[model samples]
Target chain A: MNSVLPNRAWTFISLLIAMVFLTLQNNSSAAQFLPNWPWLVMMFWVLTTPHKVNIGSAFIVGLLCDSLLAQPIGLFALLFSLSAYFMTTLSAHYKGLPIIQQSLYIGLFYGLFQLCLDVFSYASKPENSLELNLWPVGLVFVFWGAVQYSLERLSRPAPIE
Target chain B: MFNYGIHERIRIKTALASVSAVLLLILDLHFGMMNQARTYLYSITSPIQMVSAQISLQSKNLHQWLLNQEAQEETQAQLESENRMLKAQLLQFNHLKRENKELRALLSVSPSQFATRYRLAQIISIAQGSGQQVTQINKGSQHSIHAGDAVVDTQGLIGQIQHTSLLNSQVILITDPNQMIPVINQRTGLRGVVQGNIKNLKLRFIPQGSDIKTGDVLLTSGLGQHFPEGYPVATVDHITQHNNSEFLTVYAQPIAQLHQSSYVLILEQGAQ
Candidate 1:
């Protein structure tokens, strides 16, 4: 929550969030509404600084996440890069929309990301079904506004007297 | 780390990144080229995971304590949590009883028969999203927990260790679609393969008129030598066959308590 967080702080924060993500996955009670935190964070960064942090950064971050979380090795890498593609191309349209509508649009895309993941899973094993949970698709978007505000604040230069 | 000033190349770069990621996934899953890197990353992240889990648990307890200060709300929440805890405990008793019997039998068993050793492992985290019913356990390669070691609870077989690091390992649960275990009908001795069906499991490949019946208990047949023989896997719930279909669609409920088990036993066969 510092105004100017250090690099180590950022690394720690990422790891901390990764740790909480494990808890979120294990939380069977609210499985339907669990937002992909790292995806939200990566999306925020991509929208804010499209040129500096783009698809390549998304893929690397996802690779790191995949290793950290003990997922199928490059699973997160694939999901994040694909998401980065969608966000980079679609950011222009959402930029003109209101915050509420913007969140909804992003949520719609998140569902698409989930679909891509499930499709990949189905490819790996034909026994699974393609399930798209639309009920809580946008509900996970409730944190989008907060994520947007935080990233914006963190990126801002300190005000001069 | 990409910081290209040319905006035109961004789309091409994104496509390239996605393609590379897909390649990486295939290489990692099939060839396991990234296991060492994953293990090194685990060293960095697992500690944070343990700390965060503890902090989360503490925060929840504090919130529960605050709620408990009010008399009326206290009993309702208290009883609910207690009920949940009691249910989990009831499930755990099966392991303890089996362990007691097994340990006693091990005393007289020869070295060949005593090839298996059981170690208790704590579930660190479970996979999120659909089609990925995997979990990470606290024990890993250092603990001699090899990949494909059968993971069970007090009741029955749950899963097997899919991958192992120095300090932790990943388990693909029997409920995962990619995970399939060979099981046999305890009563009829009919053999079949059961695929993990997310929350439930489904028996596949059995012929339409196979002598399987509802309520038949399925035990691991150890066909692939993946899981040990004779551990209860699932109980047949029902079988439905479409007209002219060769295979009957069979639904079976898992005998093991799936995700609810906080602790599980890892069977390290031929443990040194």
Candidate 2:
């Protein structure tokens, strides 16, 4: 139990640092190629440790993301918390899934996430003529492949199982 | 503790959190009561953002340092010539400024007539999300930055301050979907409204036979009193007219370096 506390704390801190770093990269005009990394990080944590990353934690992180991005307050919070809940319910079966299947799950989840953001954005501001970008949905699969490979190489224990 | 049941507790908590999130969403959409909360959160994140920005700036400087010596020498020579030209122009510009100030005083249009005060702000972060075109700056209410204050780069009008926190603020760029600036055609002197989106600005309500042409410059008309007068906004890019329509579709590209630049002047309006 003592060892678990320190490990959990370190993991939480590392995740926060990663989120902040990703947020900074996202905001920089120099890096327009980076995707929604915070979302990926959140999803990774949720899949790996549902017991540790609760809905409240997701909500807070989402709110922080919204603030950093200058988006409508609570918009990301709502989306992220809902995603956390969905991931928590599916984590049991998800942990046992093969790498290919896991990548598909991430693609599906991220696709839905981007779709919701696009739809909400369009509805909120009709003048932008913002289209539901299927390209980002496609890109999520590619990103998941890279993210999963990196996570597998980095983690001491198997993250998926 | 009593057996509250872990699974039941998880289900109940998730439901509660989701409901609260929905409530927050409604509050944010309808009333915007959450802006204060957002401001506080932004303040908490400001330190990390500032450090990151500094790191990025340093890295960019290092990249420039690593460039070939010939390129560096060329840049230095160009800068020196530009500096000399600016110095020569500054003398004449100062004389003209003094004469203009005296004339304005004679006309009873002194500093009281408009915002002479401005605050220099550094762009901290831009909204990487889709839809809105907001940029965060280092100045905030502590620096007297208020909402609706006009922001401008060296080239032209950038946008208006949309929200203010203690040490930071959000600026809605002129290209944001919700932005509307009253602009006048520099060539024809015809007043029209310029609306913006992610793509480009559209000059709306233009008469079919309006003299606005491609490449015509547009400046803020200061009709709404939000932005100061005579700031360059955009240049007319394309014009389209349908046979049956009474209006022409005129698209303009913003003159402000909205994405590339990282600093701006926040115009603070004074008592008129």
lDDT of each: 0.75, 0.79
lDDT over C-alpha atoms for residue A4 of model 1: 68
What is the per-residue lDDT of model 2 for residues B1-272, given as tens digits with 9 covering 90 to 100? Answer: 75777677777877887788778878877886886786688777776666666776787789998999999999999999999999999799778767877888899984323455879999877875653688878888899999889999989999999878777788999988679999888888999999986768999999888888899999998788878888899999999999998999999999999988888999996423
Name the candidate that leads on lDDT.
2
Q: Write the per-residue lDDT of candidate 1 for residues B20-86, one digit (tens) a residue.
A: 8778777777886865776566666666556655665576668877764577577889989989998
**How do all models score by TM-score?**
0.72, 0.81
Error of 1 at A27 (Å): 2.9
DockQ of model 1, rounded to 2 decimals: 0.41
Question: Candidate 2, what DockQ?
Answer: 0.50
Displacement of the residue B65 alpha carbon in candidate 2, Å? 1.6
Model 1 C-alpha lDDT per residue in residues A32-58, reported as the tens digit of each score: 566667777777767756666678878
Best by TM-score: 2
